[model samples]
Target chain A: MFAPRTNRLAVLARDWLRRAVPRSVRVEWVRLRRLPRWILEAPLMARARVEDPRRDYPICLAWHESPLQRGLFEGETELERGKAINVAIAASRLDGVRVDRFQVLSYHHLVGRPSRRRGFAPGLELHAGEPAVGIGGGCCQVSNMLYLLALRGGMKIVERHRHALDLFPDRARSIPFGLGATVFYNAADLRFENPLPFPVLLRFDVRDGVLRGELRAPEPPDFRVEVYQEGHRFAREPDGWIRENWIRRRFSDLEGNELRDELVAHNRCRVCYEPTSTQTDEESRAAGPR
Target chain B: MLRALVKGAGLVAVARVPGGAAAYRRLTRDVLGTQRGHVEKLRRVVPGYVEIWRQTLERPLEGARIWIHEAGWTAYWPAVCYRLSGRAGAVTNCEGRIHDQYLSRAIAGAIATEIPNDLNDPRRIRRLRALLWARQSDELFRTLEGTLHERCVPTNLPLADASRDLCHSGGVLEHYRPDELAAFARECRRVLKPGAIASHVLDHRDHLWHADKAYPFLGHLALAEPLYQLLHGHRRSLSYHNRLSPEEVVALFEREGFRCLALRRLVLPERIYLDADEAARRGAPGLSRRYLAPRHRAISEADLRTAAAHYLFQKS
Candidate 1:
């Protein structure tokens, strides 16, 4: 179905354009099909290969269970173990290498089984349910454990999602909602990149039903990093009917161990209720007084 | 045109549309008669099964509570509830797979076999004989135990809120050793209200073990013989054939402070074999029929009934 020999050259124009440009100005175009036969034969092909260690490194993947399990079992009154796992993943950080993409795979979902008991029917078609209920109904605990471990490892945060609400009563235990990482298969992923010059190792284990995660990397020069709670506010909708609670963030360096105490001005979020018969009297009284 | 006209005439002739003004009570009476017949048949069968169950219950339950154990998927409980008294009645399940068809049928058959009249069928006689023989198979029973441990665990106990008046584990007791079974019975007694009942359906010795054939007498041999001699150089002894006779079972219950109400032989129908494949796959050779060949030397109906009897007991 070729129009002509001239048409074949047109299909390869993108490749020719890349070769014609300088390396610094051109975006790095790495094609797997164009790689040499020896590199293609290796089993570790999926791993990232970088020529410069000072620039590029793989992200460390860690796993843990104890803290995650405690938070999962006793965090909420309803015993929401699954959501706890997700929270743990968001709070975790990459260790040696910066995490570029993070994914959690539950064993049940991999095996085509319903991971929860919310809705089920008897007979041949037993393990059918919503896609979210596949494998690891409460497996977010493992993901959360990895997240916390990554944070302690001093990895930069690239992407994260927080829980819908604060899970743990302890302020330190709860990851800030907007700053947390929320992951869903094929939709959202936890990702970050290492800017440091060294590589990190991620380790995880489950013993006696407790999950443990650890990040191993060479120690870096001490840098004073202080996380501050700026202020909390309730934003009113344009119609003055809906209100959303939010927290503002400001990052700085700590000269001392103690955090600075400051009271910021508070803004009143008025209700945007539609002016009904009840409000008409108040509105009339205000106009008369004016 | 002529053919079409003739066909239309035929249709018109056949179409005798009913005139609603007429009384036409015959059709209504016939419909009512058919409905009555169906209702009568259901009334007859339901009550018959109930009566048979009640008769079975009367045979000296001493203080034993009747338990109907199934895979939990079977409609066995509703039937049992209909026949059983509501006060303190309970059902316990040891189901591995929630939707397993074979487990359901086997459990149902074990419960159904408790009735006396079911043992009259010749095919059921053969099955009972085969079950007894297969249960005695030391190798097969061990394999089945491994499978059970892997696939099934008690998941519903911790969630149960009701107090039990009677405890019954239909075909499950046979899966454990006599000591384990006894311990389980003790546990059941602990949970049961004071003066409650406990019943267990167990295996009688007289079946095959892999390729080796063992008779009911083998139970006595395996139990009475010393372990060193039986296993001379082997790692383990073939010990599952450790079944007790009716008198011994009664003694065990008495020793446990239970009153022996009734222990009678029950003969069940041959439908047990209809759903035997899964049990056979799980090393239940009696249901598998792999080693059992049709022979004239099969156990007689009376003996099969004796071997397939249900033992009922009451906690003192």
Candidate 2:
């Protein structure tokens, strides 16, 4: 939603200060303190194994990467560094991770907060409904990808947070915005509880400049998961308009027969960009909700 | 390696000739049949109505009331309307006389044939795609006359009571404002008897995307509302600019007392740019600055963007 308007001079002054200090320097100390934590967390990393499998994962559990990468990590250094940190998370926390029945895969409990000291670079991030730069800024990207894999892999999500607003444009976007998960260090995390009888393997790796990940188990999933957006609209709030969407989840049998489609969550996020599309059909009218 | 060299030499030889690209295109279109559209060929895939009953209706089309608005001049929606409703007591076709006649013809042509719908009822589409394949197009047109009561209206329809068994619209509601659409929906609801159905192909894409590739589908959002009206509105042009996303349309239907039965939306996956400076140059600078609104830039992107939505709703 829209924020209160500040005086132009104040806006300019704040921007000048922001530029003077630079976000990298501003968030450095916050990340530097994480160094000791990272060291202490080293033992946890060893628990997650990174390996190249001698055999391929089941085709059903394959990961697909996105070609729509603009505005996600715009700068080259930030982009490469974000990817490096993503690989680091895959190596140190996600790779070879296993979950037995009823066991939870707590994102923060296992991987910990992505820290600058852990070698994360400044990348695109959302702060207070706006895109901003921060240490381990794009850590949410990895978590989001993992969240999707877990869902499709039939893992039960015990806790997840959606971004306040969809910041990226739709042009060539790979997944629906409202379907994503937003992680903020230890406070906001993604946790999945395995419901299957067998243990499931969580794997992540970089493939051709894109991050590819998957959930592998001996048997194909019994219930299939597909996520979609529904009832998406821009609702006017007191301050400004925020985009609203319902992330709908559909379950199907392994044989590809649909069982039911249910509403998973209602995503209400700030609108951070102009929503314009051509009107090709007849103009139609709508009344506000009754 | 030898095959690669031969292929490269062939390409060089073609490049050496004048207008080879044009010639190749001509050959492709003429020899490869690119210019021809296969109504007959398409029929093989979708099959016919008569088979539309892969699933049965609680209310059969027989002696039912139905409405098909903006069926267009040559569209075959009436075949679908009639097949589902069958010799319905009454049928309403909005878009005037000629459009109604076309509907009548297609329905007649399809009367004799009842191929089972080939899709096995998995993909959701109501109308028969091969309604008037070229081979049967003329016969279908000649014998379209039927005894069922048929009415045609050009714009706003005038009808009363819970009379219609079914009401349908194909790709027409996207041009009206949400309020006008809501009114139209109310009209359908009023005319339809309780438990009747309303269905549509509800296309929500920016028509200009395929019309011209100069900009992203969302490029029109860069211009201020006033400027957009100036160019595409009835003030200067006949084109209507609804710019309503699929979600907005669904919301409108819901508000108008329609229960969603089925919604299969097509998501477009493409990133488009609408920069602030670009928007300013395209429209008024001051308005463009507002277009870039606080903390938001000219560029907007999202995945699973609904290009079009196909839905069925039952009147409550």
Candidate 3:
């Protein structure tokens, strides 16, 4: 959480820390640090190898695409985070691997923790509702995408953690807000079990600024699963803003007949955003947290 | 971490070595360039952002016989490249973008009617077929051999009256003096087809900010004309930079008989001293006094404060 605006020193300090080092020095330092990481991570990386890919599965479970961002190239901090997304995706990809029946695929286990040594450059991360630079910043985006894939595929969720904050606009959203997972290496994770009788094939890659993913199995699910969100609201609180939503899953037969409906989750996240057009003086005053 | 920090500190220390500013600048530039390169590689992996451009322009770049104020196309690829590929994705190193899922599907719809399958690829797509114009006869401007028309001054371009559909320029009109800008506007009106669009992006800030980031946009206003010319009057320096503000630019375009469609100041962060604050400081009263003088009766402190602006005008 950031200090209130009355604390001018905190604001100035944040700005200073951002541009403190010349872009050149920061870049060179990151690269120099990478040289030794290869030696440190050699064994662990060698052991966690991506299996050779083979496309024998005939049925498709789910596919999702998270598009590239816009206006991301204007600043250095953003540029670094964009690089981290690619690095994380490359590390997380399960191109040639298969999750056998009733097996749990640990997100952290497959992708490992993306870091400078593992070729992840700096990326933007949320620190108290403000943007900050950290190693492996955008790695969670890969987890979010996979979580959506599993949610729609009706896979048994083993462990998943939603973000403590939602910092983006819902302008061009496909998967409902609050439907994905937030992750960190070795601690927070996104894990799902394949309940099907056969193994499911995993395919994911960063293609042309998009993270494209598809899950394949020997046969498709008998029931159709559709995930949606409800009761989404942004409230003006005494401290900051809170955005919350409810995620629900609906099951239906292939013949378009609805079968079952279930409430999946209630997610509340803190975000730093100003909704001037929507939250007017009266509305914001009314929407304030009791 | 400590070692890298020490190295960075040592580099900064060398930069502060009384006469080490130039050396420091060189080192800083090199380091920033490498960082940019690393990020640029990631950018290329993503898609382009022509949708923002399309939105800002208020229309797809389709079906226009366009006339550009200046076309130095060799180094900049956005204009020619977009026309060829029609997909913003066609541009390279556009990350923090390319959000791939959004791009691959959007690339199929060209703002113009041209389809990707119609041509082998972007390189093979010769031109907009809709026509392109420029005041310079540069080979790069000529996507097709006969496409460029550079025979006359911009004030009286060789193009026929009402023949062009659009006129576009970015940060170029501010380079002209007031009289030259009026003439250029008049010429644009003369050549533009009836009701055509003229989009101009103006940078009203002092160019000195490029050299010194701490300098304010209106920092140059503190200098009197004589002092300014003496310091940066040489053609090689800042002589081409005009002092016209956003208000003056809009007034000039309107006087040329154009109806404004969209005009707004770009909101940029105030990184340097505010003009009034800087003026109250020592040795900075010249431009302030000039701005308040009899000849500058029309200009106001507020007029000078608008750092940058974008104008979408239509021929009346």
Candidate 4:
């Protein structure tokens, strides 16, 4: 369902790099090690590419093009996936970066599923989203998680938005607001730019129900990078359940200090108590006296 | 006036006469002569804060570049000339009266609430006035001495042939009648450089009068009553006919081509009022009024909200 889409993304990425690099700047392409399941899996295999391989540039990775891209992942035709990837290519140009290629490893089956069910396996427990038939329900987390990794790697953010509410209570490992990415065709997108002079290698892998991202670059100088929280809270209420969260951030030595804070969402709820028909012995005795 | 004069003379006669009926009349004449002598002595020494009548004689002469108004008594003009121009400058009575001009009853009554029985007595009251008036005149004369020809004139002439940067009159403007005020404003405008800033601390509508009117109920009461006439007898008020409101003062400045900047009200402390009252009891009414009215009978906060208004202006 997603294989041909991955190949089309790779082709679109190639076309993007061909057009994005300024004629004055030289361009090169390099391939990183590919996992077998990510590269040759049932639905689609993942592949990575680097632009300006000789000079250092930050690498950005995303799961799908848009909410419309969800249709492609759900067994939509190659033409539909092509259209979605084209929108991403056009959007990526806004940041002055080339979209090399996005590799989709498999359909995220756990998406749109509730976090708990009776007797559900402990390892297979889905942590985000409700059990519902949808296209882009849980895909935001993948992009959100990736966005945090990019920010921590000291990459310049191009566009991002916080969730309407926090879906996860444990935000220590979560992406900060203005740091998380959201992409819906022609509506929202996760974008970043490479500010460094050197090329950055973006490596992605999913293990033990966790998605991990790694950035590889040539060592410039021995400078320390620290991530600090500014102690801000963001509260979100989904339906009737309330969740409070915080944002995490990183600071680089060259840039002095940086702060990450979250905005809280307010909720209004009212409770009304009604009298019951039951009468106690005391009430009955008081009634007789009255 | 006759009763006061006769009773005053009779009191003096009683104080001096020690013998029979014939001596009484003789004592009366002697007391009257003594009173006249005291008046003459006062005429020679009591400084008047304003000299409105002397404007004509003190007109500036040719080659006079700086005109200092109100050269206070005891205002060491020689020292002032040395300090300002390193040479002597012409000294003139621009506005204020010499110490001798304020010797009469009218000026005394206008200045002090209590007239001492023996007005000839020299005390701190007389000395302080002389000192202050002298200080003021000295400051003015010294500032302009030797730099420019001095004149004791009321003419509103510009500082001709000299580059004028500042045109300031601290205690001079409030003495002007409405027309004089307007003319003074015009003169200041004519003399000052464009965009020059003028700082003036002027009393508009005698602070005591304003306080009295603003807090009529309070002014009649014990705590605030004594403040009513406190500032009434100062030479600044007696020498000047018109008292302006803050708004009117600002309007006058604006009419003279000045833009208003800031207006601040300063409240006199209680101790100053006590000192003035004590001085008034000692026979210096003007000094007493100058210090007391703003201190004691001055309006309360609520009254201030109603009566208080002062302004600053820049020459446009």
**Each model's interface RMSD (Å)?**
32.8, 24.2, 23.6, 44.2
**Cα deviation of A260 in candidate 3 (Å)?**
3.3
**Clashes found in each candidate (C-alpha, N, C closer than 3 A):** 49, 31, 14, 21
TM-score of 1: 0.27
Show where candidate 4 strays beyond 4 Å.
A1-290, B1-68, B74-93, B97-155, B205-239, B269-312
Quantify all predictions' global Cα lDDT against the true fold: 0.35, 0.53, 0.55, 0.36
lDDT of 2 by residue, B205-247 (tens): 4455544443344444455667655555542232454766555
Sort the candidates on lDDT, descending order: 3, 2, 4, 1
Q: Write the per-residue lDDT of candidate 2 for residues A1-290, one digit (tens) a residue.
A: 23544576679887898889966565565567645644443332214432533253343453645421444435556555665565555444677776654355767767765666766666667875687766676667678878888767766566798898766456765665576788766556677666554667777666555666778776665566787766566655787656666676677766887654555567778766655543111111222222
- Which model, 2 or 3, shows the larger lDDT? 3
TM-score: the better of candidates 3 and 4 = 3
Once fitted onto the true fold, the runs of candidate 2 whose alpha carbons sit more than 4 angstroms away are: A1-59, A67-92, A236-238, A255-260, A279-290, B1-316
**C-alpha RMSD of each candidate structure in angstroms:** 31.1, 29.3, 25.3, 37.0
lDDT of 3 by residue, B149-195 (tens): 43235465566688666666655677666787898889789877777
Better of 1 and 3 by lDDT: 3
Cα misplacement distance, residue A112 of candidate 4 (Å): 99
Native-referenced Cα lDDT, model 1: 0.35
Q: What is the Cα-based lDDT of residue A229 in candidate 4?
A: 32
Docking class of 2: incorrect
After superposing all C-alphas onto the true structure, candidate 3 shows an RMSD in angstroms of: 25.3
As a whole number from 0 to 100, the lDDT of residue B119 in candidate 2 is 19
- TM-score order, best first, reads 2, 3, 1, 4
